[model samples]
Target: MFSRFVAWAKRNLPTRESMEANRWLRPVAHRVLEPSLWRFTRRSVPRGVALGMVTGILCPVAQVPLSAIFALPVRANIPVAALTTFITNPFTTPPLWVAAYWIGSRILHFGEGMGVEADAARGWMEWLFSEAGPSLVVGLTLITLVFAVVGYGASALGWRWWIVRKWRARAEARAA
Candidate 1:
């Protein structure tokens, strides 16, 4: 199942072909698309997911570019890293921010008034800047870190489980 999903994802996702067309990157296109970097191997994909999650939350606006920056150095699956950033898109951001604020308030013990008051008197930006800013930053940072670690671990475990399942199936076939 995991193999199929990875295979499907690879097919659907864009390759470095478009990026390779860039004059600057064209010079290093081959290095950029090194097979190991794109392959759905246990190591590459997990690290790619971790890289993606970290960038997705931390650099919401430039998540893909940030993921690529990390992916190139580590040779993780570039497309997966880029794709995973979608986890924090427009619909999700508000809830995520809210959760982060709540978590930050608990962990850091920011006083009772973390809530945005019914301030028709002040704008949302003013509210965010004055009340929510620091806690949001700390909370988002912590959430991003936790997600990165968890994503990496889940991928690694999935890979192991897939390998074990394949081995069992092969052994059964041999016995038959």
Candidate 2:
């Protein structure tokens, strides 16, 4: 039943060329990312996921750059690093940002009166820009750093366990 669904999904999916450049870009991505993935995979899935997630969140622009790091050991690294998307994907991004803001506010006492809303942070920032420029910058910087560290550490631990367990299973299968 699942196989039939998979086959149907594959058949209905758009052609490779019809997809966006990023879709078919994995080959190049693999070339660049394999090394990093390989090195990180040596640690474990949780570690790799943590590294990837932190990298992705801290500097979204660096996703490709970080992926290149993982691409080195294509087999182990890709899967582990790809797990980073658990934290970095589109759906989770906004929530993460909000959380970062809340954390920042708690630590800095800047947003106490503002309450938490999707746009509230932005409004707070805008107000800060006009009213407290240095404080805003400092707050944002601190928030970004905190989230990055937390994301990396948590993901790494979780991914490490996952990767190790998976590898062990594979090893047992091969031995069998």
In model 1, the clashing pairs are none
Global lDDT scores for all candidate models: 0.83, 0.56
User: For every model shown, what is its TM-score relative to the native structure?
Assistant: 0.81, 0.44
Q: lDDT per residue, candidate 2, 22-134, as tens digits?
A: 65566565353334434534345445554465566666665744653553553335544544544567897777666666655566666456556734556666766653554
lDDT: which candidate is best? 1
Model 2 RMSD in angstroms: 8.1
Error of 2 at 79 (Å): 3.8
Candidate 1: worst-modelled 10 consecutive residues by lDDT: 111-120
* Candidate 2 local lDDT, residue 99: 63
Query: Which segments of candidate 1 are over 4 A away from where they belong?
Result: 1-12, 113-127
User: Candidate 1 lDDT (Cα, whole model)?
Assistant: 0.83
Candidate 1, residues 82-138, lDDT tens digits: the string is 888878999999999999998887777765554455555677788678657877988
